[model samples]
Target: MSDEEKTPEAPLAAEAKTDQVPSSPDSPVIASATTESERESLPDLPATESFSGSEPESEEADGAAILDETMSVRRLPRGLIAQILAPEDETPVWIDPKRLGRQSRRDFLLFGAATAVSAAGVWWLLPDGTKQQWLSPAAASRIDSIEARFGVTGQRRERFLGRVLTFDDDVAEALYSRNRRVRAYRPSDVTPLRNNYNGRTPTGGYLVSWKLTLSGLATGKETTLTAGDLSRFPVRDQVTRLCCVEGWSAVAFWSGIRFAELLRAYPPAPAARWAAIESAVNLDGAGQPDPYYVSIDLDTALHPQTLLATKQDNRPLSLAHGAPLRLVVPMKLGLKNIKAVTSIRYTADEPPDYWNERGYSKYDGL
Candidate 1:
């Protein structure tokens, strides 16, 4: 069985191997041969010039040219025929193994970089992606959306900013810093006061004629006192700056009795946490009687700098600058320094303020 049969395939196997290799490595390898005897003889052409003629122009080879050039191309098939057929720019040179390797590596790096950057941007834009100390991610995203034209509008902007303002107010109270006082400057540091009357400006000279009313005392009684009665308590003065909600400030010298001493003379009822102050009736620009009123927490009423001022820069109070008595609380913005000889009523709940009702902050603290 052995020797004859085994050797039978040997010669033909070697011949098949050699035949499978095309003349040009770049061209398609054609036709499989099951056995050497299956090979057919190609017919000799009618007659044609040998390709040994000047190699035809590398111009496009049509079907006729393909038959004529088949011999030449087989002799140098390394894409020569393809180059002739393909557009100059689309010539399949990029398919070369080494060049394709470099192009693929460069493309892979660029694609990876772009994908990573896009993913990070998407993460930051998501509402819950980041935890921040000041602005929440949701707020940040809304702000970004508004700026980036993602459909957020001015009304939405206003709503979020209102929330931001509320949060801003909360941050100050969170420190539990009621005891922290403002820096007091020297008398020489005092500057001229700026006129910032809201609804009405009083004409000068209510001094001596003015009286202060105190109500809702612990005894449930009300008392009235003149500016002179306030001098019975500690009369003190300090140079302090008055900051306004309108973003301006003035330093001034004010002399008055410490409001704490006044509270000692007439303590508020046990449940009272706020003191409401009202000015003598003053008319508005339209000539209507516009009331000026505000409230302060009892805690603020107790600060050392809280004063019932009867004088400024050594002169008696001018009615235009709140004659006879004006409450001076430097820890608050200029608005809290209620003007005019007025009444102070103690209450358990905050009283409605003139400006607060008109959109100013209730706690206007420094």
Candidate 2:
């Protein structure tokens, strides 16, 4: 397919406890990001492109904290739709005309019941105006009040409110993370894979000898294995939607060894709460040198749908589609589903994210 037609892929996140918002190595950011301009001066990436998360951007006046998320959850194209559908995450799982009427009565009823419970649960937690239509306007009104008192207007006002509001939305997503598993589909249902990226794929020559390295194990030991070793582990195949923050999604069949198998082989330290997946040198949408990475909660990484994806459809992945090895986690947004994974490190705190530093949500679970 042509570049314009193919789905665009984005950046990922990953850093050790020393930092949660990983800045671009060569960015001209001020050391003390205490000032709003200093914080906003980060990457300022687009929404669909993670590897670089480009949502809200905020930080404490002290600059001693994670940059506040101002554009993530609230800024996604499907954020409103996800809220409108009244379900957990931004996936409008019900909007697939292709899957309509494909389920038996039992499955359909179960899905409906689950969605209802999720809606009620969130409603009870967030109330009517917090995240719904009333949110932005209400926030605007409050910002107006602050402006009258402090003469704040234009971008400053937006930064303040954007940070506050997106933070609210991010909290809601992280809190319940409803245990609703996305529906799996048959191979026949697979659609053409869609991906867009500013970075070039790792050369096919390197992938021919690529191997996944596992470290930061709870055991405090590290090991490396070749593709042949991974093949020995039990494999999982599922067709699921890869949802993008820009609001497009596509169904694709992914085949790979379950992450659980790898965990069993290399258990994380009890203190390790996040898995910081690192990748080769790549470029961000801005064409900056982006050592693309992302750190996901161990819980999210261990979800059954998550995979150390080695194949898309029935064949080996093309370089354009993250050849050799990539992450395929259906529950998280596409950005979190990192491509071209080179190493996996377990960290005590959330690792710095490429996009989080660039002004997107730190926890962009779908």
Candidate 2 lDDT by residue in tens digits, 241-341: 89887788888899998887788878998899899987764556665556888878888777778898888887987778877788998887788888878
Segments of candidate 2 deviating more than 4 angstroms: 1-179, 284-289
**C-alpha displacement of 82 in model 2, angstroms?**
37
TM-score of each: 0.55, 0.55
Per-residue lDDT of model 1, residues 280-340, tens digit only: 6555877566768888878888888888888898998776678778889888888989888
Task: Report the error of model 2 at residue 41, Å.
Answer: 51
| Separate clash counts for every candidate | 0, 24
Backbone clash pairs for candidate 1 read none
Worst 10 residues of 1 by lDDT: 41-50
User: Residue 69 CA error for candidate 1 (Å)?
Assistant: 55
Reference-based lDDT, each prediction: 0.67, 0.66
